[model samples]
Target: MTEDLEALRSAPVLETERLLLRPFTAEELDAVAAGEAVAHFAHGFPSAEDMDFARESLMAGGYFFTESVYARLAVVEKSTGEVVGTAGFVGPPIDDELEIVGSLAAGRRNRGYAQEAVTALRGVAFRDPAVTGIRASVPEDNAPAEQVLVAAGFVRRGTPGLETEYFLPRPA
Candidate 1:
């Protein structure tokens, strides 16, 4: 895990017109998990919920730092040069499929930032060629998240339990 943390320093970055989906440095991930402020994070960025999620993911296996399409990239607003959220794959491809997750600071929502970030992530995943499909799931009532995935070209799959699933296959 320590080596993974060191490797995270050089993780690839994906950019969009208005956002940069950059991987979090180990230091930034540490700060977020500890609920401490990172210099480049926007006000209210990495909300309490985000902090908890980071901590949980870190303890699980540090997969976010793996040298693969799986990563927890910070979603930075290019104009402000501040991190407004995070978007990334849940882990390396499983059976040639990967799952993605994203979240934004309260103030950043509804601005199409999430859509842009997810689109960037989707492009990165497909670039690997080994990835055949990408998936994301939103809570049943989270219309905005569902819309973001749809806008990124993810098709509605089905409701599996309390969450609705969306999937985007590699471009033909």
Candidate 2:
């Protein structure tokens, strides 16, 4: 278990055709976790809940480690080198399953960034042999996120209510 945790803490950066998924710097994670403004972000976080989520994720990742698989990573636009969003597991996997969460900057939405980021994160999560599947829960009315998850190959797993659950099993 210690070796597994160490490996997770040293996970590599992930990249897609158009985005770079890099771990958040300690300072950046600290700021977001504290609900403080991040200098490089064009627009600040969308809401307090976003900051809360960031904090929770940082805690789950273990503060002071930048490469933990549960760490919230900056979703950078490769061409512009801009941080357009964040992606990460909600926490470490349990029973070979984990939940993924992501958010795009307000101005960066509707651009397919969420789908790209989520897909990249899924790859990262599955690289660990322990991970067998991933899941996501989005508000029932969040059609955009639902579409992004669907495009990333997540299928609805249960009845919809205030929130809908989606799951994606690792490829054979």
Worst 10 residues of 2 by lDDT: 57-66
Worst 10 residues of 1 by lDDT: 3-12
After superposition, candidate 1 runs with Cα above 4 Å error: 1-10, 60-63
Tens digits of lDDT, candidate 2, 1-172: 8986677667458888888888877777677778676666647553465577667656666552346677667777898776667787766787899888888878888887887788778877887888899999999889999998898889999864789999999999
Candidate 1: tens digits of C-alpha lDDT, residues 33-136 = 88777788887878886787679767876665433457777888999999898888777778999898878988888888887887777777776667899989
Measured with C-alpha atoms, the lDDT of residue 169 in candidate 1 is 95
lDDT of 2: 0.77
User: Model 2: which residue pairs collide?
Assistant: none
